[model samples]
Target chain A: MASAERIGIRSDRDILLARQRGRELGRSVGFVATDLTLIATAISELARNIVLYAREGVIELRVVTEDSHRGLVIVARDHGPGIVDVNRAMQDGYSTSGGLGLGLPGVKRLMDGFEIHSRAGRGTTVQIAKWLRT
Target chain B: MDVPVLKQGPFLIATVQSALTDADLAQMRRLLIEQVGKFRSRGVIVDVTAVDVLDSYACRTLRDIAHMTGFRGAATVIVGIHPELAFTMVQLGLSLEGVATALDLEEGLAYLNARTRPTIARGNSPRNSAGPPRNGTHTRGKR
Candidate 1:
């Protein structure tokens, strides 16, 4: 089990750093250019969620290696007002800010694995992984 | 720093430099609209070739910026999107709805230029000219 590297998501600039770090980590884990960009964009969306929804948060990047499988994992954690409705939030065109509301759905489509946990008043944590083997 | 909205002839070119902070993004948006109003420019070319990342906010802002430019009667072209970013954006479901994109800065400028030039005066565009198409993308049908 590889230890995760943490990147803070406090501002827009922080999202840029998170994306860069995610891309670099994805590249090191043997991801193709397309996969690298996907991983980075996923991080960017998640990190911006922290800044936009919650005030701030953290992103943890780790590599997954199991037997013959290798992958990149991302964990986004935010301790802000949690989503009241996960189902509605995941809808493609649902946005509270007059946006296209493509963040959550798009992130899901990019990664090989996705999961989310949240408590109304507590916070939210989203974990995503992209496998290189298959 | 002021995001330079340069004027070349009748159009405007806004190049986003690196390390743009949240406040900087706001400033650029404000200044871009201001410059468009001040110069009454016909079209705008937003060059993001130097940009490496496109977050959710960045994506939404871009789409919104293009819309805003349209409201001012100025056509907009987004250029220099990294190939990877474009691919990822498509996966992200960010249709950008009504945005026009180009491969590079030159293509963007040419697209905008070709858009504003006298359309009917060219005598059917020489269908077989040796030169590159005046419109790189965003052609014929118009957004």
Candidate 2:
């Protein structure tokens, strides 16, 4: 079991770096090409949210196993204006940044396990994981 | 890095050589639209063969480029979306609605040529009158 990797997200460049790292981690966890793309895309959406709303954040990538099943986990954390309405944020086509509003929902759909913790004026944290299929 | 936009006859082709940041995509959009108007191009092809991920921002930028270029009287086609990327995009609900896509650069050019032929035939512009002949070779069958 290798240690987790953390990438600071402060700009658009960090978004790219985070996703690339997520893909590499997913590959090491035995994810296929399609699954790796899914993981990378999910990371991009999460990291972009940090850049767009928080202006700074960290993306933590880790490889885990449970009962012989291998998986990759991603945790995106930011200390910025948190979500006023978590449910609304989860809804499709509900964007506050004039975006497509598919970021959170899209990430949820891509990963097998999804969790979000946020507080207004405090920050937001999203944890997503994808398990490898045996 | 800036994506290189090459002028191919009456079209502009921008090839994305690697993973592009959001800023890079926005800049490319601006450049493509500017060059399309500057060169009076009839079509634009964005080749993303080397891009490994097409996230929401990238997808939206491509669609915006297509729409913006369309307003300038040039059609836009996105090419070289990997199979895995396409699947992931679909799952993410990034439909890329109203944006044309092809398998690769060749198919994109063919589609663009087929689409632009009718307007040229209608004598929209005398400059494009000497464009490629009306051959059936460029016609993509049943797609």
Candidate 3:
């Protein structure tokens, strides 16, 4: 049983580092290959979005376990022009920025539990969870 | 991600150096579509063999590249889709529809070579004759 955490430094490099942190932490928790892959994918998406949309942001990775079941929690927050249309962004073929607007919805589908909060001109925060054995 | 340039006959082959996740898909869309339109080439080979997973986002991106490249009068061949990833994509029931994929980079290059080499052999291609395709296992597709 192990526990660890990390914070993204609001830079492009930090996005990669955050994803690496997710893999490292997942391995520390003895996560199997499938679960580890899921965590890595989710973390990479969130981190990449932070760098792409916002000038900078932070990412938090935490391990979780319940009744011997283990998992991961990934939280990515960014200070950027918050999304004006959350619902539209979630649509598969819809993209305002025109770059493959699959960041949020894609990551949400990859992980087990997903949540988002954003306000215009304020900032955006996204949290994702991946179960260990799922 | 470290994408290495490999030369295969009349084609410029390059393996993707990172996972072809949603984020990467977004970037590649711009690079391969908008940017590639500015230049002319006989063909472009993108080896996604290094990728371990493929999702709707990544697949859609590849499809877009193929379409754009075709519009530009250049052929785009997506090579080296990992078997596991391929299975996952099929199982997920998400079809990319128009993207061409080979088993490995070599095979992909061969496919391109078969099409482009004839043109190059006639000195129509910019690259030289009697060359083979470049191969590298790069990029992630696990998302």
Candidate 4:
């Protein structure tokens, strides 16, 4: 676990900017289209989720390397009404509202490592990690 | 942003390459308006297969295409949206509202073909003018 560079995107404009930043960071770490797409998608979903669901949130990106293996970790946390049932939400095709239900769960599946913690009436925190080839 | 043309039967199939980002949205919106001005097309089948995501901006652009094409006596259909991507959108609570979506490319073209049926409009200009410019409909939906 290493320190991550974090940013806040309160407005929709910031979301696009953040994604561009993520892309630059991803490239420096040797991420290809597949990895870039997954990271970009995950970041977009998380950032959009924050803009839509919470007052605001933070996006954190960190570089992780060990044994010649390089990877990136992304964590998004929102201080909104926490999810009551994280498990139920993780279930594919389960959506609270109308659109596709792939936001959180989709990001989880796309990443190499995923962890989420949310308490009712509290806030929700999602962390995702993806590996990069040297 | 690149607009690649694939010739289908009796119609030009325009596939928008790259993600339907703010830039592409702007371009598509312009083309749609231009198409309406020219009034010379059977219909257009938009293949979004290469696109993995469509934001609110893209959604607005799609809506614009559907509306503008309707006025031009042509129709548009969106196809190849990944199920997972669709699912995520649903969760995000974004709505394309009336824009048609197909499971695959073939299905999308068929839907557009079926809707080539004509509809009339008095004049053609952009509607839903309140939102900020998205894809470079500059000073309007400009990105």
Candidate 4: list runs displaced more than 4 Å.
A1-4, B1-42, B45-73, B77-143
Q: How much TM-score does chain B earn in each model?
A: 0.77, 0.83, 0.68, 0.69
Off by over 4 Å in 3: B17-41, B51-73, B83-97, B117-143
Q: Write the per-residue lDDT of candidate 3 for residues A1-134, one digit (tens) a residue.
A: 34767676565456556666787888887776665655665676677677667877888888878786677888888888988888877766566656655666667666778889988898888888877664
Fnat value of model 3: 0.00
Cα distance off (Å), candidate 4, residue B27: 11
Which residue pairs collide in model 3, if any?
A: A10-A57, B8-B132, B8-B133, B18-B139, B18-B140, B19-B140, B20-B140, B53-B141
Candidate 1 chain B worst ten-residue window by lDDT? B120-129
lDDT tens readout by residue for model 4, A1-134:
22457889686665666666676688788887667766776787778777777768889888888787788888889898878889988887676765466567767766788999999888888888889865
B1-143 per-residue lDDT for model 2 (tens digits)? 89999999999999999899988999999999999989999999999999999998999899999999999999999999989988999999998789999999999999999888764456434544346545553333332
The list of candidate 1 runs beyond 4 A from truth reads A1-3, B17-22, B118-143
Among these predictions, the greatest lDDT belongs to 2
TM-score of each: 0.83, 0.90, 0.69, 0.60
Candidate 3 per-residue C-alpha lDDT over B7-125 given as tens digits, one digit per residue, 9 for 90 to 100: 54446566787754455556665665544445545577888866654554567677877888778766788887765555545433456677677777777767776666543445433
Model 3's CAPRI class? incorrect
First chain of model 3: TM-score?
0.87
Taking every candidate in turn, the Cα RMSD to the unseen true structure, in Å, is: 7.1, 5.4, 10.1, 12.9
**lDDT string, candidate 1, B24-131, tens digits:** 777777777777789988788888887766656677777767888789878888889888878887788776678988988899988988877755324345552435
lDDT on C-alpha atoms for all candidate structures: 0.82, 0.91, 0.67, 0.69
lDDT of 1 by residue, A34-92 (tens): 88878988988898889988979999999889788899889999999998899888889
